[model samples]
Target: MRKIIVSAAAAALLASGSVAFAAVKHTTGTIKTFDATAMSLVLDDGSSFTLPKTFKDPGLQVGEKVRVSWEMSGKNKVAEAVKIAK
Candidate 1:
């Protein structure tokens, strides 16, 4: 029984660690392009991200500065949220 408890605790710790590592990443830069039809945006630095369909549109336009929160989905960087930068 004690060994089982220890094993369960170790598994829980590892699971929590993975969740912590999956934290969202943020980037700030000018918008080079925003394609609503394609559901994607490119930054001035050439970094591009696929935006989720539920992502709120801030009426983004070319050259507008913004901050994006994203995470890796397979091999693609998928944006979870975006906001205009002050």
Candidate 2:
């Protein structure tokens, strides 16, 4: 019984650690292109992100500086939020 409890605790710890590693990441750069119809954007530094279906446009445009909050989903960087930057 004690061994089983310890094993469960270890498993839980590993799960929590993975969750922490998967936390949202942020990037800032000038917008190279934004295709609202395609729900995607690329930064001048060559980073690309796919906007969520529920994402609202914040008037993104080429050459605009913006910050993107995102996370990796498979091979894609999925954007959680986008905010225009100064």
Candidate 3:
């Protein structure tokens, strides 16, 4: 009974941690610049984010609307996903 209770508590803690880690913010704006060499992008709103090397191309181009999902990595904003917004 004690082991079962401990296991349940551990599972709950792990679930909460995952939720916290998955809490990424979204930004929507026009693509001001896309530096493929640097793997980063800047929005017209003056927001800049670093992209993960594994990020797939979303057919990005300047002057196009896009939505970016990102999270804070250290002192930098790291992009998790990007999508072209109609």
Candidate 4:
């Protein structure tokens, strides 16, 4: 009975921890620069993101407003998607 309670508690904690780590961050701003070669972009607000190697161009352009979905990898914010914003 005690072992069962402890196992359940551990499982609950583990589930919550996984949910916390699975969070996808988001940012919205005008693009300041874009480099297809580097697979990166900088926002006018100074935020920068590294795009995935398989990323396809979304017709991004400087001064265009955008919404970026991303996740943190080491010290970099790796972009998962970039969408043109109205």
Of the candidates shown, which would achieve the greatest lDDT relative to the real structure? 2
Best by TM-score: 2
- Better TM-score candidate (1, 3): 1
Tens digits of per-residue lDDT for model 4 on 12-86?
A: 999999889869999999999999999999999999999999999989999999999999988999999999999
Across 35-63, the per-residue lDDT of candidate 2 in tens digits comes to 99999999999999999999999888899
- Error in Å for residue 13 of model 1: 1.4
Model 3 lDDT tens row, 1-86: 99999999999999999889768999999999999889999999999999998988878999999999999988899999999999
Q: Model 1, which residues run further than 4 Å from truth? A: none
Cα lDDT for residue 18, candidate 2: 96
TM-score of 1: 0.88
Model 4: lDDT equals 0.96
Alpha-carbon TM-score of each model against the true structure: 0.88, 0.92, 0.75, 0.88
C-alpha-based local distance difference test score of model 2: 0.96
Best of the two (1, 4) by lDDT: 4
| Candidate 3 residue runs with Cα over 4 Å from true position | 1-22
